[model samples]
Target: MSTSSIKFYDRFSKLYPIVDVFLRPQKRRLFEEINLLDHGKLLEIGVGNGTHLGLYKKHALIGIDTSKSMLSKAIDYATQEMQLLHMSGEQLEFEDHCFDYIVLSHVIAVVEHPEKMLEECCRVLKKDGSLILLNHFTPNNFLGYIDRAFQLFSPIFHFKSAFYLKDLKALKKIELKEQIHFSRLRYFKLLIYKKP
Candidate 1:
């Protein structure tokens, strides 16, 4: 992530509540999927305010973020089962193939280099491990054009409005295991990938 991107998130951390209002409905399914997951070391990139930390009971979750303000907000959700770290997803600090699962929730498009982030995720993930991605990947329809239009203002918001799953270079190393649409508008998708 860039310095400006980090600054934007730190400054706008308080606005997440308003963002949450529209996001909560979709997040219900996201959390449901996560809550049912059985895993070992799991990394949740961009853990935001950590409101969903309690939802994860069967996994040892380690959440990482580039913003200190966001990490501070997520502190309250920390537990023996979960650890919060101030780190960049594009450059993870852990050793190779350490995590059993990596969850990239609503984060791929917001980073400065989405591909680099995925590369890091894949690097740290064990072979045969799952990478769960919950993101807004643009479709080929009118809704996609709408997202593309918003790309102009994405810099001001620090996120891409028209990110596509095909643009992810990390796909070369991972196989798409499942793709599910959870949002009411089918704008956001939950993609499960397995590293070969």
Candidate 2:
């Protein structure tokens, strides 16, 4: 994340909790589409305000975000066991293949370099571990062009408008386990991929 991006999020942090209310339904659907069992170490990249902390209580949880304001809110909301780190997804400070599971919730679209971030993610995830994604990707149609056009406003929206699942370079190393689309327009999707 860029310094300006972190500043933008810090400014937006106060309202993020309220904004997340509309995201609850999709969040619920994401969990329903995947199985989060006794995986030992679970890392949530861009864990905004620790709103999903309750979901991974069974695992040793680590949450990372770039915004200090957001991380502060997360600290207030998260249980003591959950470790909150002020970090960027593109440069993860972890040993190779250390995590049992990695979760990206509405994060890939906003990252500066999605491929580099995914490369870091793949490097840190243990072989046969899971990578779960909950994001809004461009559809493969005319609407996608419209979505791409909307990239002009990404600075205001805080995420790129044209990010697609097909753009991920890490896909070649993982097998798609399940995909569930929740939006009426089929824009929002929950995807689970297993590292090979």
Candidate 3:
């Protein structure tokens, strides 16, 4: 993450707990999907505040984020079994096939290079291991156009990390055994990919 992005989240850390309260409904649904995974080591990219860490009861978890402030907040919740690393999604500091499961929750749209991030995810995942993603993407309807227009103004709001809808297409380069879509709102997508 850039210094500006780090600073932005650092300032917002005070408000994040409050923001997370309102986000529970969507987060719950995402957590429900993740619960389907069997127990194993899991890597969560962009693990902000570690709010979702409690959801993984059976899995040993490792989380990475680019913001030191966010990692500081996450450490408060970290158990002796969990490890948190300060790192960027685009460059993962791990060996190949190191994790049985990889998670990207709302991280792709915020990264400078989504494809590179996905490549790293694939590289770190074991053969036939799953990659789960819960993210907001462009709707297939008119709402997508509205999102596109709003994205143009994101910079003014200091949301420089937001990406437009088409970026999801970059997933095509990765080999996936299955792809699943959930959620009533077309704007939100849940993807399940398997390394081949």
In the range 1-196, model 1's lDDT, one tens digit per residue, is 7899999999888998788788887677877777776758899999998777777778888899999999998888788667899999999999999998998888998999998999998899999988988889898788898998999998899999988888888876899988888645678898889899
Scored by Cα lDDT, where does model 1 land? 0.87
Candidate 3 residue-wise lDDT, 92-186, digit = tens: 99999989999888777766667888888888889878888877777677766777778777654345333544555556655555444555656
Model 3, total clashes: 0
TM-score of candidate 1 on Cα atoms, chains taken together: 0.95
Model 1 weakest 10-residue run by lDDT: 30-39
| TM-score-sorted candidate list, best first | 1, 2, 3
**Could you tell me every candidate's TM-score relative to the true structure?**
0.95, 0.93, 0.87
Those runs of model 2 whose alpha carbons end farther than 4 Å from true positions after fitting are 33-35
Q: Kindly list the per-residue Cα lDDT of model 2 for residues 1-196, writing each as its tens digit.
A: 7888888889988888887998999887765543455647888899998776776647788899999999998887788788999889999999999998898998998888889988999999999888898888899877798898898988686789988778687777789998888856788888888899
Better of 1 and 2 by TM-score: 1
